[model samples]
Target: MIRSVTMARAVAAALLLLAGAVRADAGATFRAQFGDAFLDRYWALQPDAAIAVGYYRYAARIAVPDAAYRARRLAFLERSIAALRRLPEAGMDAAMRTDGAVLLSQLEQERWSLAEFREWQWNPSLYNVADAFALLLNTPYAPEAERLRTVSQRLTQVPAYYAAARAAIARPVREQVQLAMQQSQGTLDVFGEALERQLAGSALRADERARFLQRLRAARVAVEGYIAFLEALDQRLARDGGGRDFRIGRAAYERLFGYAIQTGVTPDALHARALQEKERLHERMAELADHLWPKYFPDQAPPPERVARIGQLIARLSDNHATPAGFYDEVQALIPRLEDCVRTHQLVDLDPSRPLAVRVTPPYQRGVAMASVNAPGPYDATAKTYFNVTPLDAFTPAQADSFLREYNHWLLQILVIHEAVPGHYVQLVYANKTPSRIKSVFGNGPMIEGWAVYSERMMLESGWDPSPEMELMYSKWLLRVVCNTLLDYGVHVRGMQEDEALRLLRDEAFQSETEARGKWRRAQLSYVQLASYFAGFSAIYDFRESLKQQLGERFDLKKFNDRFLSYGSAPVAVITPLIGAADVSR
Candidate 1:
């Protein structure tokens, strides 16, 4: 007995020593990797750094790359990848290993895609950077002193960034000419607007005002040069099938979809699935529409006239209930109701750490808002959430009516559920607390968007119908998702023209021509992004149902949600592996 006890004690001691060694090694490695990442080339590309450090401390004083800087950037990226590759992956925990692997893969892919794929050679518009600079400077989150300092510095770099941008325009490829043109226009607008804002402000010193004017002139010159280049490029591409051939080809597109989205499904397959789901949603909508609108206008026919009249009546109802003053008021009132719904359904765990609020979209991004929620970035400890609604401006009485009718009490409740409560705000609050920076920063849009859409349907399923009118609105939104998928695939793969795309939007989604046209433009510019929402939502729904069946009595909403969100916002591919399930990838 004495001999056995001694042996057991020795074995236990050895295990403790081994565990201590592992922890020590991991702690050092974690700090080193994080330190390197915080100071590395990745930081150079990030918008927050530009806003927080570049503008304030440096005073927009960085030199523009002239061959040397470009070489340095390329080398830095390569070295970072090589260094990360050399890091020991053996001792890390599952989460750490997953994050490390994903980061390494991302680094390698970015290097290959940008340097070898000649992406920079073809799509060299610095306007994206400029826009990032503009937002960082202008947004309310930044301190005033920081904003002013950064604004001054960025304004200083404007000339150099614009010059580089113009130089890039000199060698435009055929396929990306339209994108290039749009970028050119966008950059000019940014520079012009910034200059106008700076000059108009009373706080600027004489030297600052003069500097702003000088930079403004240079920016204008660059814009003119870019325009000239576009005109020439357009003519050149017109002879070679109008740049249609210049796109991320099938293999490359697939690779990007896999890397960026972490989904194995091809864009075409996803689009097809979106269409299928869309049809299913429309059938549900039609049934609901018939149930509600029959009282207002009784017609049992289920074809063209019924559909058209139903749409007309919805518009008329929206008009009748329109209240110009009540938009904000209505939205505010629904918050408590949404909270109660979540608590009553017990869909998921609500963290006390999570903070949520509703606000108007900033003036600069108002053009893009139907409604949106900006999640706190990876590093933020505070869970700041913004539920931004676009303010109405200069709407005619008829237009106002149409708009207000859509925001009736029940529809407003649905919107609240969709945008706040257990939707984006809730999901993002969980995501913000995730430990993996790589996963948090490179979050899967599909997962984020999919969760929000699923939440909308989940509320409806939970017997909180709000009203039939609201149900109809939800259906209309679902139809839009279907149309969005069709339009995305139609434009990118099937070569659908603008007019044809708009026609489909109007006929299928029941959108006004103005809305359809706007969607068509968005479809042209954004390839396959919309399909992520529907595709993602469908996957979530399936995963939830399957898990419920598999777990049976063990199934707990709070436990499942907490476990799922703890994985962060990685691609479905990575997420599927982490969750130990094949169902989510589908």
Candidate 2:
């Protein structure tokens, strides 16, 4: 009996060794086949995206948004998905597995976008080439001569690019067509003066310079041609009163929410959560306002209604803001202070070597959000991360005052915390450090936005700018986050109109009238994006709290933060399990 048992054990051990060998071989094969070849093909199909991500080999290639190119892209996506699925799961380590999943999700989303959702069919603004051209001019990724040469090559394709765009667009959404006209007109600057400046600085031979100048003029004409096409479309739609509806409706929004968020929470559930969160925030804000009422009002009794009291207090606080002329300068000055807060608090280890620059938003990229972080590609980890703030330079005096009040001093600090320090900039710096290029490149939207939203609260909790007034303003700021989800879900899914949306923002959320109007316009122009801030923040904050409970006294804040960010910009759903397993094992 003992001899028989020993023989059986030996047989089992040998089988295990064979399985290990199979896994190792599978891993090697998968990497060898998919690593470089797949990326080269993928980047070739998406040259502008390649430029954005620091893949410079495709810098001069321009993708034509025509039916044939799209069909080819769809086929590529399907084949890649199939190829990824063929890889043995046992072969991949935790990081590799996560990367594989991230890449797969990205592929599936793109496929759905082309085959099912088909934004390319309806969204005229999707065809803008200015951002790519602007990147070539401004990114400093290559030397002036090399970048200018790329511009010259890319200009050759501009006419064909716009021709394809014009053909592809049919019965486009009215809001999107208007946006396309504005943006396309703005892009003429990049091709004209911007190109002229670059050409003036370039050492292109006399002949090359002449050809470059000629191409520049042609590119400008092509851009103007596209704008003219949009204007004609607009006029036709205006006369006929026929255009595609901006609302994506419930089905498309739900599907997109799944792909973009990946939080394992349904849009219905997230919407419900936002409603509950809004109520809780309103209650908290009211309490704080009540607490500070006597100080601010001195003699008058507080309003009996909850919103009225909160509104009164916020109105008083809004007065303490920068003038219109000082808004841009104020944002720039806040960056250093935010840097010091994170360092002093030891919130997370920051890499000062990674540069973050504050700059005005490029004209081609304006009309979306007021501020955004332009992070370097994972491939170019050391490049500058621009904090692009849309200046109020052209706003009328009244418009500027309303804008300044919306971004009052206390709220502006929270904005910087969200946009710059310990927010998008800090998280992206760490995302670039992550070894998985897939996770860094196919970054989860909710994860990126969530970390930024979370950073706002995190900084406040760490006692930066500790004051009752700051606390009150943060509650109001956080209400905006919650309202983003509510507003997006309302507009896209429930067919919410402008009047209702404006009231939700201006009344319930205490946003200024100008802010409310802007958000209403933004909501129409985009879908499933505003909710990202709330969905991401909730998942990340919940994960941290759950970890705190699990670890008890042993839970270290800095370690927890650093380790959480180490996973790159992956879905919080994926990172939570890895974090839990790692902590439990430790």
Candidate 3:
């Protein structure tokens, strides 16, 4: 009986090994047959997107985004979804299974955008071609002459691209049209000095340069015509009130929120959570403000109300900010300080080879966020990640002062932590090194934004600068994150008016008036995006705490952080299960 039992156990172990080997073979076959083909076709249909994602093979081509192209793209998505569903999942490894999920989500999202959301009909900003041209010029993935040649090839399509864009519009959004006008005008810079500088520095032959210059002129003409088209659209909409409302109502908002945030939580639930978070953060900020009241207002007592007290302290601290001319330079100086802090604390490993470049935000990409990190695609990990800061030179003195105060001394450090070292920049570096290409290319937005939000609080918690003033400012910054969700859900899902939204920002969130106004505009222009910060932060922070509880003393900060980021920007919901499974096995 003992011999028989041992032989049965041996047979079971052999079967398990055989199953694992078979699954590995199946995963390899699935990738070779479908995964590669899907991306190749996807890139061809989305040349601009391909360029953005480091697929340079289609650098010279541009999709017109007309009806025929939309139909083809839709067909491609449907076919790919079906093909993916037909494959048996039992034989796939965990990583490959995650890739399949990411790819499916991507395809489904695109199909929804094309079919239901239908931004093409109402968003004139969707048609900008200049940014792609600028990217082809800016990214150093290829040699100057070679990139220039590709730019010339791509320039030939600009006329048709804009023409198709002009034809595609039905009842366009007023704010979108205005934004398109600004961005399209700004795009002219790509053809002017930016292109001229590239031409001057290029090693192209004189004849080649002349031909490229001619193509550039033609593209410039096309862009100018498109801008004129937007101007006319704006005028007509103003006169007739024919433009569609910018607010995507609750149903659309909920759908978008689901796609944008893959978590099971509803938008209403997130909004409720954010409202509660606001109160919690307010209590904390008031406590910190009370602690620092004697330092800043040594003779005076604190205000009776929590909001007033917090606002009073933040207003006083706001005065300690950089000058308008020095704003960009101050941001540049903060990067090294942040890197040093991350290293000294041993928070996460730093890659010196992946240098971060701080530059003024390019003309074509301005008017939305003040600061953003443009990381290289997973395919091009060696390229520098740009920390793009919008220049304050264009702002009026009042606006500049307001903007400067909004990003004052202590909060500026938090912003650097959020956008640069140990935030989006560091997380992206790790994401690029992830093994699965699908996870990187189809990276989830909430996961990306959430990790940055998480990093800000994580830094202070880990003792980066534990001053009372820094703590108060961070509380204010964190309130902004919570309020981002409130503001977004309020405006889009709840029909929140501008005055009410501004009140939420200035009164509840304690944001500068300038910052409040900018956020209101951002809320209008972008749908369901601001929620990413809070949704992501809550998910990641909760997950970390849960793991810490599970592991007890075994939880290592660096290892948890590294492993969390190793999944390559998959949605928090998707990543949580994988991490939990790994922990269970351990």
Candidate 4:
């Protein structure tokens, strides 16, 4: 017994020595040393972001982060990066290495945005803090009175935040200025209409409610003042300077590509690739049009111009859209069908019990995204994922038709696939399951959006109602994806003006005038974001193909997909190595 004790102690001592030796060989694993503190600092700097991500610890305290605060945040990032650089990758496993890479990429992107782009000086949208305040009311993370305290506190700071915003504007973009003004109007409604009614009905003390109402009135005045300032800025710029160019320039755009597209491909390369795909997609669309020409127009001959032919084919499909009143119901009715199809094919795992609530988009969140998935914040366990479909009730008949045509019956299913089932809603649910909080909050736009677009193509491939009309609609949707990348560069780097963009969408992508016009504004209002849809889908799909080649006959489609998504929404570049490691281990 004594000899056995001695032998066990010797083995334990040797194992401890081995662990120490490994630690001495490498500095420390990233998650072990850097993750928690870094996340804490990130939340501290951007509490609004934390709130959006479902953290409610600071819900009652309104935060109006100013210019000096932003500068300090950038300085903090630099220090974090320097510290992180000293922590070698030697000790990390595949997952830890991936988390470290994501942090580095994120910090660098933010650094570039602050130090170089100086978007605070150029983008008026930065001043739109309404979403932060309004979110308190929209979410159910806290009790009524607790949420109201946040609304009250944030409202009181409205004038101060507006003051900081006004002082910071040096060379604002015209499109962003206009968008801010438009969004400000919606925000006013939030305070005047929504918040007012909310406060009256809530169970807050009389004194608290009275004081909150006073702050709300103050916020109204401040908002109106900001709106007036924007109007004057607009007129001055239009007559004298007309603001700065909306383009982010080639070099800066390429730098942005590094953050947004984790793939090593340059923006120039991506743009060129998009051009090639656009051509091919148009050809596929034309062929589908040829197949359907006789069905749509029994006796008439097909048009000579491919654009005209495709337009006619799309118009025929557009005739099947729901009316303004029934639009929401139609979208809601279509939900179960998509859910049923995804399950029938065993495409991806889903919890039928998981909450996917469909509703009309609030006024503030509308305009940019016709439909968007508001996934539950990473911190919120009980909140449902909202699939916000913008109502057509407010639009003119002509406007409604154009919007409906763009989202026609077949196209509607594709949109739903991209926005809800087996897309953003499903992927985000997977994202929330991951242990890394950083990956969930600072998700790669390319991967988040790319997966959705890829799912649309995958759904069609899985033999979900493989009709020619469906194929044509799907092909046209694919063109929109390609055109999105093309137009982003075109406007931002290629000096693409309004007419050129409109022509590209209508002629090449076969988008209606309504859709094209809305897209033109979206392309201007946003920068490089449009590219993510294509870049993400392309990289992810290519990665799948590579895995297929590597694993050969051993590759299982469902398993491959589930495995790919298991790492949350890390950049595909970061995700690639992990997948390679996983494949090797398997």
List model 4 lDDT by residue over 1-586, tens digit each. Answer: 9999999999999998887776555535555566666676677777777777787666555445477877788898899888777776766556666777788888888888888889988887777666667677878788888889877877777888888888888889998888888888877878877677888899999999999999989988988998999999988989898588888888877778777888777888999999899889788888989989999999999889988898888888889987777878888888888889888988888876567999878776766878998776678845778899888777899999888888888888898899987899989988887877767777999999999999998899899879999999998999999999999989888889999999999888889888999999999888899999999999989988887777777777777678777778888787777666255323
lDDT assessment of candidate 1: 0.64
- Runs in model 4 lying further than 4 Å from the true structure: 1-29, 550-553, 580-586
Q: Looking at candidate 2, what is the lDDT of residue 272?
A: 96
Q: Best TM-score goes to which candidate?
A: 2
- The lDDT values for all models are 0.64, 0.88, 0.88, 0.83
Model 1 ranges off by over 4 Å: 1-31, 34-40, 45-71, 85-90, 116-143, 170-249, 299-340, 343-369, 380-385, 391-416, 576-586
Per-residue lDDT of 143 in model 2:
84
lDDT of 3 by residue, 1-586 (tens): 9999999999999999999898978788778756767688889999988887778888899998789999999999999889888777888888888788888888888899899999999999988887678778889898889999999888888889889999999999999998999898888988897678779778999998898888888888998999998899899998988789999999889888888898667998999999898888888888888888999999998889989998999999999999888888888898888888888877788899999999888888998999999888876788879999998888898988999999999989989999997999999998899887888888888899999989998889888888989988898999999999998998897889999999999998888888999999999999879999989999999989888887877777777788888889899888888876245223
TM-score of 4: 0.93
Give the deviation of candidate 3 from the true structure as CA RMSD.
1.9
Q: Which clashing pairs does model 4 show?
A: 237-242
RMSD of 1: 5.4
Cα error, residue 410 of model 3, in Å, equals: 0.8
